[model samples]
Target: MKNLPQKVRSKKLSSRVDLTAMVSVSFLLIIFFMVAAELRKPKVMDLSLPYYDPKWDNIITCSIGVDNRIITVLLDDNNRIVTYSGLLFYPIESPKILSYGKNGIRKELEKRRKNILEYSASMGKPKNGPIIIIKPSKKSNFKNLVDILDEMAITKIDTYAIVNDFTPEEEKLLASK
Candidate 1:
């Protein structure tokens, strides 16, 4: 009777495997790597950034004020207000800044580069390049800064810095010049 009348009982089980241990290991590895990795912030490795590098030690800075169409040339370590020159201005109604994007500004940038090269060469500097700092005014309205930024990006200029403050006379000088 035990061999012939034994009733079969079927037990159903789910096919999915329990991933608790695997998930625990994954989280543990993430924590391990996070703790093992360095804690310092990364620095950008390219472009016109002013570094302690002696090559750019005596670097020059220039400014384009919002009051008018004057480009100021700054000198010295203190970054003091220096002589301002140049008349590459466009009327406010039709400012020379590129519309939509920097395709137009690219050409202007080339001209500026050539002009800067000439100026640097005339000054007998080591290289004929534009290592310039652009300081646009706070009241700037033409949005030329955007185009300049786009141009800088396209030209791979990552090291450039911006100056934001200036004196009343600086504005006056910019306006008169």
Candidate 2:
């Protein structure tokens, strides 16, 4: 009786695992990394060069050198600033020696621009305005060039040139400064 008559029983258990939460967490981590790994944008300055035109004969050249000096000249037999219409050169005003800033070079530029506008209006000619040529000397640093460019923007100058070559007069002026 002890050996033959016992009934056998077995217990059942589930072997499955819930992977939804794990998969969701993995996707969230992936998305977080993707969102956080974006690259930064670089800063830059925009500059435009003036197009050549026979009608645009009037040119204003500003030479920037070291020692915080700028020599502004208009294209003529004598390098001088133009005072009014008919290409009148202001012999009294030799390329004004100016420093950098709102009070210094910026003020001078605004005044010059104002003069050009007045001259064009009086002459009954469409205001092409004076074409500014920026010439930076070897002694001039990058900061000086950038400051001048900022001045150009602040002054609302639409036509300008960044000339690499300097005239003999400009060289002398730069040397003197």
Q: Pick the candidate with the highest TM-score.
A: 2
The Cα local distance difference test for each model comes to 0.47, 0.56
Provide backbone clash counts, one per model.
Answer: 2, 0
lDDT of 2: 0.56
Q: Residue 72 of model 1: what lDDT?
A: 35
lDDT tens per residue, model 2, 1-177? 478867877876788899999999999999888867753345566333334445437654222111012224322222222112121132224555666778776787787678766755665544545556676766666677777778889998777777777667566655654
Candidate 1 regions off by >4 Å?
1-105, 115-128, 141-144, 156-159, 167-169, 173-177
Question: How many collisions between residues are there in candidate 2?
Answer: 0
Q: Which candidate is the best by lDDT?
A: 2
Candidate 1 global CA lDDT score: 0.47
